[model samples]
Target chain A: MAIKEGIRTGGRSARVQASVHAAVRELLKEQDRASLTVPQIAARAGVTPSTIYRRWGELAALLADVAVERVLPDVAPLDTGELRADLRAWTEQYLDEITSEPGRNLMRDVLSSACPGYCTNILRGQLQVILDRAQARGEALPDIERLLDLLVAPTVYRTLFAEAPPTLEQLYSLLDLALPGQDPATLCHCDHRRR
Target chain B: MAIKEGIRTGGRSARVQASVHAAVRELLKEQDRASLTVPQIAARAGVTPSTIYRRWGELAALLADVAVERVLPDVAPLDTGELRADLRAWTEQYLDEITSEPGRNLMRDVLSSACPGYCTNILRGQLQVILDRAQARGEALPDIERLLDLLVAPTVYRTLFAEAPPTLEQLYSLLDLALPGQDPATLCHCDHRRR
Candidate 1:
């Protein structure tokens, strides 16, 4: 997040940017994405929204960047030396944050107006970072993409769109099933017949 | 649905209520739940919003009723003696719809909101009708609630929030793995290693 924020050549210097980030986090904690308009954000940050507009491109993009940057830092790097354990830990992290009021509320807002293509980009971009980091040291590079989709799809549907929430145990179990031997490609096609 | 709509003095007129059902669905397709004003619906339906409001109370409640009534007719009766097959068949109906433009757009609209609880209510009420009907028929209903969540959650998360679309084959494989005729009570635990 610091890295991304530092990328901008901005009118709002370091002090102002810090204030803006603080205000964004405040709105996020409140889980009031709808109420966090540019003017409101400006008021919160003690600056004009023109300051916000200058720094971040648009309303959605600003929120999108903030959401990804704030949330992603906490979820990366789960190396337990065992794929199943690592996946389980990550799943728990993902589930806990997502199921909470803040997480669910933020996800609901993002998903409501999200474009399918943009969604794919953000997910692949974010999850890929985690996947690549997890598999960076390993020899047999497996495609976790399909398995990630399968493993997490149900939870997202249920949480964001369905009636129930997928429990932590379910998430761990799904990850275990998906990463039977640190291999999602093979696991995806595993003989999942009625046992 | 008819039973619920029967409330609010809309007595003994099935024929009149049918057009309202179609109008809600049509209106929903064109507008987000938030943007959908009663006047817009009335105009489209060739009736006044008052007429629509008089027929159905609050906008949310009216929309909710329409949602219940629209999908209820399409759900396959659980008479087919198999759980996996029945769910597969049930999910199969909307495979294309969920993946295609309209379904995908509507899904994105719903999830991008920051209010999970309200969204959950609408989804739960609608999906539960199907699940309740299936369970009522006496098929070995194991984790019917979670299973339904598991089925729809992943795709929605991926499509709406993550931006990835699941192919029918992907959905097929998820169902195969998720509801495999094992002790569904076990999977219902959703916890891999158990507490």
Candidate 2:
């Protein structure tokens, strides 16, 4: 999907877009992000500064557009035929990807961008797909917001801010909490009284 | 506590620290952050540039220091003689402050800083105090990590990224999910299959 609606996506426009995105990716690997400028990016992409500005508005917007494309899942979440298992697999894979070096950088770009909601919507859409499949199978599930609050939020928060990302087992426990009738107690091994 | 360990906190040092921090806060209100330079801050604070460089090391470090001070809780979370009530009250107040304009700006500053974990630790410390008090009352409660994963993480994540900060009622449901023996289904009014 286009990062911004109403943008033309025909042949030449698409070619310029790909070249500019590739330039951004290459330059990010080569230099500090704060040093990246539209003129510099345009020069590297073999396009004029006006073209870059006309298409993407500014450097932050350009970076955000690239980040959204990088982060959007290329395939639907795997169907495990069970809601909990499906959620577990999806979340674990998400955690792994986001905690990687490039993933973390993309996350910062998206968050720092003017349109952070694009990335948020992408994530919410993925979870909604999982929840919808579960419902189709006659399985009871918590609402999408519940999953966002308990599952996606924590995973992203820990990945970005904590000393380390949540473990696979911790991801399972969070999924347990979000799914109906799953006893989170059985999955939790820590003593409640221990501070 | 000092933002960096071993920094002197008495007399001239304290005065310089206050002045420099005040300068940053003032400049942030007065001008675009990307255009702000250490020399300008030092000029405004009436301190030499070397002094700022010596103490804070750089602008991001200085900004992180100021953000931590701004975001840290000024008082203990109020006690309501019950674990759930206490958590709910504390979280509601936390949400209010973080979602406000100044709070939102401070959250961005902290997240963008070089030492994000300082702010993270401050938040964790506050939650630990609440959990400790609940434990003292002989109330069964989840561990500190559980609180971070289920409550604090989502609160921070949504405040920073979502379309709007979560509502007090939504905060209540999350607290319900975190506390032992509390049925989240009872508090969540939305239909699970609706989405």
Candidate 3:
């Protein structure tokens, strides 16, 4: 292959790896996740098939890694003093992505895979990476990770695969019930503001 | 269909519709949302192809209606005194449903669908039915309805459809951020919360 060779780890290598990474990202954007083949990656990267395969076992693995990498930085979530603001920001970013052609296409192919384990594994890994980051920052309340999952899981399920939007109003409503830091006793009560 | 044609409501004819409904519900219990079809539904009901299409338009519509109907009272959600307790109860129920054959199957199929609008309609309708009833009883927090879409949508998407399950920790945390009712400034963030 004429494009590049070997994993470049040094300062110069960073540029090469960046190129490879960019190629991978570009492939994902252009092709359906299901249709992605090593030949294509190699052709696009100007690298050998062995290089792509050696670097990543399969397309799903590569896509999973790339998805985690590319998606997080832009939409990784902001946790200011308030959870709602942070989440709204998070939701807005995700909304843009999922509704986008590339994101929607990528998710559809990924979720439609026959192997349930793979689907679960990639999504779990991607989520954990972001959630762990949020938690480490002290922005996460107890069960904040669960909040992230609950808030998001249903919307996607209802939308991408189920093929419905499930009303933004109701979705946001559920989010209010689910976000973080509120005392359960108060939430449970009719009067509510005992604080 | 002849099992109770003469009788109405609780009799044999009604029993058959009941059986069809039950079978549909049970099938949802046992399969992934990804692996559904009219033949499958018919087989599950021990009925013929004509019986299904004659009665229902398509697999999506039938499943949508059946799944929606079953989502209501068949599995009671949390109405306990404390919000956290109720949330825990609800989460527990969701966990049970998802883990069950029908729950997993139905969810998988629903989330796997490509038509976002259609899925949205079904889930929105289902959520509305559930929330409306809860609201009428005055147990539901006013703002929670609006956020409900954000909260539950993501969970479904994240779990069977997205990359991971919303960890129990996330769920608990989200409830806290949500339930306390917003401050005056925060109140303006959402238009529907005024009720």
Best model per DockQ: 2
- Give the poorly placed runs of model 1, Cα more than 4 Å off: A1-57, A112-142, A182-195, B1-58, B67-90, B100-150, B179-195
TM-score, predicted candidate 1 vs. hidden true structure: 0.59
Complex DockQ, candidate 2: 0.31
TM-score of each: 0.59, 0.74, 0.55
DockQ for all candidate structures vs. native? 0.27, 0.31, 0.23
Ranking by TM-score: 2, 1, 3
Estimate every model's Cα lDDT from 0 to 1: 0.57, 0.76, 0.52
Off by over 4 Å in 2: A1-62, A184-195, B1-59, B183-195
Model 2, span A38-96: residue lDDT tens:
99999999999999888877788788777656765457888999888888888888887
Which of the two candidates, 1 or 2, achieves a greater DockQ against the reference?
2
Q: Using TM-score, give the best candidate's number.
A: 2
- Candidate 3, residue A158: lDDT: 46
Task: Give interface RMSD, per candidate.
Answer: 8.5, 6.8, 8.4
Candidate 3 CAPRI classification by DockQ = acceptable
Per-residue CA lDDT of model 2 for B1-195, tens digit only, reads 236532235788889988998999999899998999999999999999999988877788788777666755457778888888888888887887787777777766766766556656767777777888988988887777888887778788887777667888887777766777555345333334244
Q: Chain A TM-score, candidate 2?
A: 0.71
